[model samples]
Target chain A: MREVFHQSLEDVQSRLVEIAELVTVAIERATKAFGTSDVTLAEEVIEADQVIDDKAIELDELAIQILARQQPVARDLRIVVAALRVSASLERMGDIAEHIAQLTRMRFPERAIPKGLKSTFTKMGEIDVQVANLLTEILRTEDLALVEKLRTLDDQLDDLHLSVFEKVLSENWQGEAGATVDATLASRYHERFADHALSVAKKVAYLATGEWTPDTDSIAVIVAADLAAVRENADGAEA
Target chain B: MREVFHQSLEDVQSRLVEIAELVTVAIERATKAFGTSDVTLAEEVIEADQVIDDKAIELDELAIQILARQQPVARDLRIVVAALRVSASLERMGDIAEHIAQLTRMRFPERAIPKGLKSTFTKMGEIDVQVANLLTEILRTEDLALVEKLRTLDDQLDDLHLSVFEKVLSENWQGEAGATVDATLASRYHERFADHALSVAKKVAYLATGEWTPDTDSIAVIVAADLAAVRENADGAEA
Candidate 1:
């Protein structure tokens, strides 16, 4: 029975890693589509979402089965629960990537985004890659120190988001409607991507600390930067 | 040990319901402030958030302890895991309410929002109350049906958010800057509140189905409505 339980646990972990890998690929493909306006790549990202979704369901079932069979206690139980939460976060990340891909498909063929905003999208893609890397590290080592590093990375994403907004609202760009739409969508995708990354970090923190911390400082900093960016943009418009 | 686990579970449930109550109150207060431009009421919502945050952490720890001690299997394990996710969603709801209150404070003394948007805000408040009630039912009965009902109510909130944006971008609203700020913040708060409600519903679904189905049709509907509203508003402005 113990051997069976151990085997099931390992199976669930491996499946989770597989789902994470799919999510990373989805992010990469979605961002590539965004940068190149490749509708075919976007379609691929959308089509591949089912695999991630199915794997997430498989992991949940495995976790439930392990709990029912082994009745894991203490640390073992925490590990199972953490795996469930992390899987959900990863699933959400996949969903966000699909969302970005869908937006790309909708706004394509027109080259709606200007050159300036392309760099913003590129920045977002970089952040998405960082988030994917963080998930890999957490799964590989379950190390809290590596998870702690997500805070600074999340802050950088926030800064890039604010800068994107500032550039969108400025007169140098003629405030084109297409530009605004691209900027808004790009900002939202980055913000939400960072949010999922933070969710993963929170799960890792729980594994390490045995307690859940809200980590509001990161959000506060984002909000503060948002307010400052809006103010600066408004002033620039007035001038 | 079983008795202790049961008691802790009960404690966590009670606190969850309490937090739900606070979320409803904060939503009500923030909406009222939006209607009347009452800074004092908004301030109350902001101040009350600390209590919500504290309870969230406390309940999270209690749930973890219960899991560690009881090593609950199957349904029991699902219930504990659901509780943890629900608490996180509730905490996020509290944060959204506080965010709206902050917006109210920022727009004070001059009434940034016009009278035309009051009905829409009131409708959003109604949806908020419904979501809170749905969560309370979830805790009381663990009824999957009632939780499913929340998905529709979330759509209603999204509809209300669309109308708010329509009013903002319409020519009838000559004061573009303040209206834009008010509408942006209002839409964000409403959308986020609905998102949290959906998160709670997802937890209930997992508890019932043992599968992460990611039923987001309701959100898709809401997003479609937003796109239509934005288009109509822009067209009307051009006319």
Candidate 2:
């Protein structure tokens, strides 16, 4: 019975990694579509999200079955619960990717790229890649220190997001509707992507520390304050 | 043992409802501060959010303890998990309310109110109240059908949000930077509040159906398409 339970545990972990891989592709495809204005790629990302969703449901059922049958204890139980949350974070990440894709599709053909925002957008894209990499690391290594690092990495994304808005507003380019919309949406997508990544980090942190301090508000505050400062600076310039 | 376990479950549910109430008050306070430029109320919301966060952590630990000690099964397990998610959502909702307060405090004292946007802002406020009500309903009754109805109600909030952007853009009342910032932040808060409520609904649905659909994209498409139609209709008036 113990051997069978261990095998089931192994199966659950492998399936979770599979779902994570699907989510990674979804993020990559969605970010690529946003950067390149590739509507077809964006649509593909949107369609493929359903697969990740399906996998999450399947994994949840599997975990519940294992819990019911084997009744995992202590650390093993934590692993099962962590699997549930990781799947949830991956699913939310997939949803954010779909949101980005939808935004791309909405502003298509004309390709409303924000002016002087390319580097900022590219930086956000890099941050997103970092998040995906960290998720993979968490899954494979279960490194508590690395998971702790994600909180700071999320802060970095917050800082980049501020720069994106500041660069847009400070240039006195407010009249360009398309550019403004693109910048706003891009920043939102990046922020949410980082948030979902942080959710994964928090799960790992909980597993390691057995204490849950999600730190969502701190990240939100950092991002909000940065944006507020930019807007204030813009107001001063206008005055 | 079972009686003690059931009583703990009841205690957890009561705390969850209390947290929900606090969040609802926070949302109201924050919105009022936004409308009236009341910094004190904004500060009050910010301070209250910490208590909400503490409650969330407490409830999570309590649920985990119950699960560890009681070894609940099937329906009981679902209830515990749903309680965890509800606590998380309430905490996130509190964060958003605090975010709105922060934006209000930062942008106020300048006191630039948008002339024609008050009605729209008020409408967003109403939507927020509806979201709060839905959350209360979810907690009080746990009715699956009512939870499903929240998706449709979320569609209404999305409509109000698009209308906000259209009104701001059409009027070209872009000079009042503070008001524009306020409107933008207000709209964002409303949208996020609805999103979190939808998340709670999804959790409830999952608990009841034992099936998770991950239909965020489908719902987004519906909302986006509806917004597009509204925009098209508004454009026709200009033409």
Candidate 3:
């Protein structure tokens, strides 16, 4: 029975890594589509999102079954519970990718990168893709070091997210209402993708170190404050 | 042993209800602050969010402990696992309320509703508050009938969310970049709060009905498509 339970745990880990890899692909393709305005690739990401959703559901069922059958206690039980959360976060990351794809598709002939913020978005997308990859690696190998690396990338993505807002809110900005809307939504999607990845990384870290951090959206408040300061400084300079 | 497990389950249920009540209050205050530009109220919501966060963590610890000590199986095990998911969703609902408050405080002395869309956001905020209240009642009563009502409110919130984008993208829009950003972020936060509530409702329904629906962000994609259609039709009429 112990050996069987051990195999079940391994199954959970591999499935998590598998879902993470798929999320990585989804973000990579979605970002590429957003950058190049490849509607076909964007459509692909949209359709493939269902697969990720299904995989997450399947993983959840497996975790529950393990709980019911193996009756894992203590650390083993925590591992299964953590898998449930990691799957949810991964599913959300896939959804963000789909949102990015939908943005590209919504703007078909036109670029979704919006005018004057292409480089910032491109950088943000690249960083998000890297974050996804690192998340997959961390889950696959259980290396705590990758969690810190992922956190750094998430910080960078947050900064880029702030920059996107700064550009849009600048006095010299000339984009139309549609462009502004797209920039705001798209930057948020990109930044949130990395945020979800970092969240998954933290869960993995918790399973290893046994020091759990409460996962809350406190980052938004800090980011919002920084944005307000930057906007105020810009306004003061203009005055 | 069975009686002890039953008691543990009841404890989980009551704690969930407690957290849900706090969320209802948070959304109430946050939305009120957002609509009236009450920065102090917004700050209150923001400061109080940590309590919700801490409570969620405490609840999670309790759930983990139950899982470890009881080693429940079948429906009992599923109940504990579902409690964890529900707690996470409730925590997220609290975070969304905080985000709304942050928006209000960030634009203090300046209304966060954006010009020309005050009524839309006001309605959205009210529906969200209603949604939170209903979610708390449902958790307390386990009345699956309320789930349908919750779904209806969520649909209303989604429409309002779509309309915010429609107003922003319309040619009649006169708001500058700041208003656009706030509308985009604020609308998203309001819609997501309802979405999280609906998700919890579904989980409750699942617990009773034993029918599991995959919880994915498919709603965003559908809403995005609807917005696109609305935009195209408007453009066609203009042409």
Ten contiguous residues with the weakest lDDT in model 1 chain B = B173-182
Interface RMSD of 2: 2.6
Model 1 clash pairs are none
Model 3 accuracy (lDDT, Cα): 0.90
Give the DockQ (2 decimals) of all models: 0.31, 0.40, 0.80
| Candidate 2 docking DockQ | 0.40
Question: What lDDT tens digits, residue by residue, belong to model 3 across residues A1-239?
Answer: 99999999999999999999999999999999999999999999999999999999999999989988888888899999999999999999999999999999998887888889989988998998899889999999999988889889988988898899889888988998888889999999999888888888888898899997767676787799988887787778689
- Give interface RMSD, every candidate, in order: 3.7, 2.6, 1.1
Could you estimate the TM-score for every candidate? 0.84, 0.90, 0.98
Residue-by-residue lDDT tens digits, candidate 1, B1-239:
77877787788778888888888888888777866789899889888888888888788778877766677876787787778778878888988888777767766665746557767777787788678777777766778878668878876777777666566555565533334545655776777687887777777677678776564534643464466557555766687
User: Residue by residue across B59-88, what tens digits does model 2's lDDT show?
Assistant: 977877877777788888878877877787
Q: Rank the candidates by DockQ, best first.
A: 3, 2, 1
Sort all candidates by TM-score, best to worst.
3, 2, 1
* Poorly placed runs, candidate 2 (over 4 Å): A148-152, A209-213, B111-115, B143-152, B171-182, B205-215, B227-239
Model 3 lDDT tens row, B2-93: 89988989999999999999999999999999999999999999999999999888899999898888888888888898999999999889
